[model samples]
Target: MADFLGTDANPSLDGILYPSVQGSEGKLNVVLFHKAARVQALDIPKGAEISADLYVETEDGLEIDYSVWEEVPPESPSATSNRDPLDAREPEDYNGRVPTLRLNISSLRVHRVNHIMFHTESHTVRRHRFEKRGAEF
Candidate 1:
């Protein structure tokens, strides 16, 4: 649980890499990851039947178990009072909230921020290139 939004960090990127996320490869660097791709719809793009063996048998990456990029550490109350919630190994980012079921509401809502100027064409990208597949789930 310490990938810290590396999405299972250790595909190796101590710097920068923009590879074409082939398989079993992910990364992280905050920026709210678009509120975890609008609550795990991954911003809705893979509609070609999701059949990479049923997306690796029901893909449950949970965007690396709920990306919490609250400006790299933006929760207060002295960071939620130094938790002790029965001390069963604590590492929580309930940013993707359920909260004991108060109608199961998720959180994170940052509106209004659009200042852009983007261009990256290193031959159209390919950075942390990993191509060692065949786990087959």
Candidate 2:
């Protein structure tokens, strides 16, 4: 997936940074990414904690209101997986994978939204193969 802010044609005026989750029924879906070699794996441990603050930004690129955000953390096993199901590969069938942390926010009030900002923090263990790169190798 492209960087939420980087891909915007006119980031200043056009406020929607990421495509809103359709059929979400008033829920916000967030995917977290980490920079690593293609073959590397991510390992988040059980009971790991992830938190984020959501903000609604104004047209002038200033934060306006604090959006009420609640996170439904991914299942422990799903969170610890080496590969994210949403990750796309080069060959379409390649084993190449990227680790992603998914969070679902419920009960957010959005109005005249220009852009959304997320401040996130995670407490988890991330592991990768030393020699070859990923857990699979």
lDDT per residue for candidate 2 within 1-137, as digits (tens), equals 24544244353222233455453446655443323224343344455565555656668776756543334556654564588677776685675345332333345455676776665588999888766666675
**Candidate models: Cα lDDT each:** 0.38, 0.48
RMSD of each: 21.2, 25.7
> In model 1, how large is the Cα lDDT of residue 105?
25
Model 2, stretches more than 4 Å misplaced?
Answer: 1-64, 68-70, 84-137
Question: Deviation in angstroms for 62 in model 2?
Answer: 18
lDDT (Cα, tens digit) per residue for candidate 1, span 16-111: 335343233374342322223334223222222232221222366523232332223343556435667666653563355322222222664435
Extract clashing residue pairs from model 2.
Answer: 15-114
TM-score of each: 0.14, 0.15
Clashing residue pairs for model 1: 19-127
